[model samples]
Target: MRLVTFNILHGRSLRDGQVDTGRLAEAIRRLDPDILALQEVDRAQERSHHADLTDVAAAAMGAVDQRFVPALAGTPGAAWVPAADPDDPGTAGYGVSLLSRHPATAWRVLRLPRIPFRVPRTGPHRWPQRLAPEEPRVAVAGRFATPEGPLTAVSTHLSFVPGWGQLQLLALRRALAAVDGPVVLLGDLNLRGRQPERLTGYRPLGRRPTMPAGRPDHQIDHILLRGELGPVRLVDNPEMELSDHRPLVVELGARRG
Candidate 1:
């Protein structure tokens, strides 16, 4: 199966400020991944013309099964608060998403606790605002029905704060421990592959730089595996203006070593 991870930046094109829905659609259409993990997807946000990115992406990729995990809730281009239950899994806004060609067996959203806000040493950056007391961040997970068996897939956008991401990683590791069977974790960890074992038990398929506009010094987006699934391959989306970060795609088969 082909899999991909992308930070669409709400479908905005950095080139000429144009929204290349067709380009986005064509890319997804060509890739036609079996499973896709997407970040920064917008749903009804005024900026992207109130477009439901989840729907558009699925349609573009021709995915049969699709669902999204909201990182926060008020609207796109805004900070959000997770459900009080942190583990509620029903909230939606700016979180991660999983789109698959297979059916879904089960799904849930596990909210990762954030680091206490510090009075910015410098100042808040303009885009992708920081979390306030009200809005919390989270990771979305789904157990899907694959021909091989039940497969657990998780998608998340981790915290960008200094040491805070470590805490979020701990929470994610705990949440994933509950699943039984082959598992795949995909998303923008905001961390590099320097210490994969420390963040997640699985190994990263590739270590190519995946951040910053033009100059990427770290491999932020990753695809990891647990147990045996089959052969896996990492695919890099050719340099595009869709977002600051490039998309990473992975493919899986029915057999495993």
Candidate 2:
């Protein structure tokens, strides 16, 4: 089974600053991931032409099942509110999503704890700036009935602030512990290095840098596995200009009985 994690930057191309669902769909079709985890997904947002990005991606990839959990009620970098109505399609929001070709039997969304205190931003020269409010975060978990067995997959986008991201990671780990099958976690964690592995006890499946698609220097996006899912390897793709971050793809072999 193939798994892919990508931060689509709300389906906007960094090269042209355009949000074209057609282009985004074609990009996902080319990747052809069996399971896809996405961050920075927009739904009914004016910026992205009120497009349900997750739905578009799912249709494009021909996913059998999918789920989208909003972390916020409005667009990022703009005036936004908290997400309250899960059934309201007209409500604009930003969040993470999961798409799978395999049938999903169960699903859950875990809302992570946000920092109570405001975090101050730093200037380009590393000077302290005005305080900024912490955005709400969430994790979407899905239990898929794969040929190898049930696989629990999670998609999340954590805070970029130091210490706070770790707290979110810890919460995610605890929530995932409830699942009884092999777990595959995917997202643009924002935290660097081997911190995720150290925090969640999940081994990183891919090491290729994904951010700044033009010339990435950090492997912020990741696909991590908690239990053995056989010999997993990265799927190589030559072109990656759809979003700011390059998509990370991995193939999971049948589990050994």
Residue ranges of candidate 2 with Cα displaced over 4 Å = 85-87, 120-130, 235-239
Best by TM-score: 2
What's each prediction's clash count? 7, 0
Per-residue lDDT of model 2, residues 122-170, tens digit only: 7768887778777888889999999888999999999988888899999
Q: Residue by residue across 1-257, what tens digits does model 1's lDDT show?
A: 77677777777777767666677777677667788888887665666666677888889877788877676675643555553544243334565678988898787878788655532332346554444443356777888888878989888877766566677877888888878998888888777765555667786665567776467766788887877787655456545567788777766655753
Per-residue error at 119 for model 1, in Å?
A: 5.5
Each model's lDDT comes to 0.72, 0.86
Candidate 1 has a TM-score of 0.85
